[model samples]
Target: MTEAIVIAAQAGRALAEAARRAGLRPYVADLFGDADTLALAEAYRPLSGRFGSGPAAEATLAAVDGLAAAAGSPVGVVLGSGFEDVPGLVARIAERHRLIGAAAGTVAALKDPHGFAALCGRLGIPHPSVATDAPTDPGRWLLKRVGGSGGNHIRPAPRGTAPQGYYYQARVPGRPHALNFLADGLRIEVLAVTEQWCAPTPMLPYRYAGAVVGGASEASSLPAATWTVISDFIERIVAATGLRGLGSADFLVDGSDWWLTEINPRPGATLDILDRRTTPLLAAHVAACLGCMPALGAQPADAAAAQICYADREHAPVPDLPWPDHVRDRPRPGSVVRRDAPLCTVLAEGADRQAALARLETRTARLLAVLAAKKTHPEEAP
Candidate 1:
């Protein structure tokens, strides 16, 4: 079997599973060596890094080299998240192995706040204003890390100067939505538009919660002109930046008015909800990177949702409960899970978006309840 290397903070499970679906043996290295990820991957290596902080370059390279040596002529590497902040590390990885996604320059350009804002302006796309220095009206702006994912790096802009590796972006109005698409350096094939919500805490108000696949009803609610604008923006940005393979463009949408947020230049969190097609998306992603846009299969008939189940309090050694089939990215039997850290992902499907999200809520609540009960009854098998 052909082998591929998968790396990310926590999203490696989704990518590793996708690689298996694509008929590739995946060798994975990530921050979290979840039980499901270990099962999906042929070989797994645990990275010594935290989420939001990019993986250490030397350690990541060593892990990749070890995995590559174990496989029988591996195909290449498919990065998920955590490398966006350090494009130089990405370039270094590409030097040692073939990269099956966006190039280093592309990542650097898109992750650069000033460069992306300028590109949006040049293309006549609506984007929130960005500045390196602190805004006069700090209340109207937000501070964001240069190449942050998962929204934990965002906060209300404070008065005075901006911190290093962070910039201020004018706050915009609207709900969070993302356009997941596959690009072949020039053209793009949109896969799905997902609606995202936040798992807010006092300190990290914008931390990502989950996403639901947009169903037919949700699609009909948006005006046709909104899609046209989105298409135009995608076409322009792909042509300008040479973005390749799986990518997601985030947007703030309210009625027909929309503002382009940042672009995640790799397979994003929505992959869990959106990668249900007959043709494996990883195959399409590899083909797209090779400059051939494969015919995308039809979207799943039912709406699906995936939500992260964060630990309410710290678990020094998590109880070995009977995890349901719908739960994914499961931690090992006796592992430490910090408060506010992701414990596992709960997935659900239904007739429509609302129904799917409702099922997700029920599943999440039940899982949390189970964990709490298990904590209280330490000897319980469940």
Candidate 2:
């Protein structure tokens, strides 16, 4: 069987499962060896690292080599979250295996605050102003790491000089939206536009909460002029960067106006919600990287949403409760989960975005309630 390597922080399960759907045996390496991931993967290696920080490069490459050695000649490596900040490491991996997504240089250029800002300026895109130094009025700016993913890397700018590897961005007021698309270096096919919400903590106020895929209603909500501008922005950026495979362009939208914020050069959190194609998106991603843009299947009729269920308190050892079919990224039983850490993903579908999000809230509440009861009465736990 044809094989492919998948790597990410938590959602490698989604990629591994997609690879299987694409008729490819997947060799997976990620921080979490969740039960589902282990089952879906042909061979799994647990990488050691924090969530935002890409897995330690040496260990990751070693794991990749080990997986490649065990499997037949793999097609290529499909990366997900956690690699954006470490382009040198990405280049190292590309040396050994074909990378089935954006090149390391593309990631480096897009992740570089200054470079990306300059590109936006040249392209005449409405992007937030970026600077290495902190703004005089810190409250009007946000501090962000050079290559941060997830909302954990963002915070309100502080006084004085910006720290090394961090920069200040002029804060823009709007709701967060991500345009997930597929590209073949020159052109792109827009997949879905997801509305994103945040799960805020004291320290991580911008922590990613969830996203809802609104089909036609979402399209009608935005003005045609706004979409034209967005499409132009994507075209210009792709033309300049040669971005390939599955990627998402993030934007802040208020009324009819929108500002491009960031571009994720790989499949992102929305894969769970947007991977509704008959031909698996991973397959299309590989094809796109190989310069073939496959036709995307119809969008789902019903709205869908995916939310991260974060631990409210530390679970010394997570109880072995039966996880529902709607839940994903299930942590191993008896594993310790720190407070504020992601427990699992809760998914829901409904007739529309509001309904889908409402169902997500209910499912999240029910799951949390079960865990709370188990914590209070250990013997009552299943």
Model 2 C-alpha lDDT per residue in residues 151-195, reported as the tens digit of each score: 998999999788988999999989899888998888889887788
- lDDT values for all models: 0.86, 0.86
Q: Residue-wise lDDT of candidate 1 within 1-382, one digit each (tens)?
A: 3555545444589999888888888988888888899999888887876433345677778887788787757777888888888888788888988888999999999999999999999999999999877578999999999898999999989987888889999999999988889999898898887889999999998999999886644553346778767977897899899999999999999877899999999999988888888888999999999888999888788899999999998888988777899999999888899999999999999988889989999999988888888888887755
**Per-residue lDDT value at 142 in model 1:** 94
**Which residue pairs of candidate 2 clash?**
none
In lDDT terms, how accurate is model 1? 0.86
Error of 1 at 249 (Å): 0.4
Rate residue 293 of model 2 by lDDT: 93
Candidate 1 lDDT for residue 23: 88
Off by over 4 Å in 1: 2-10, 50-55, 216-218
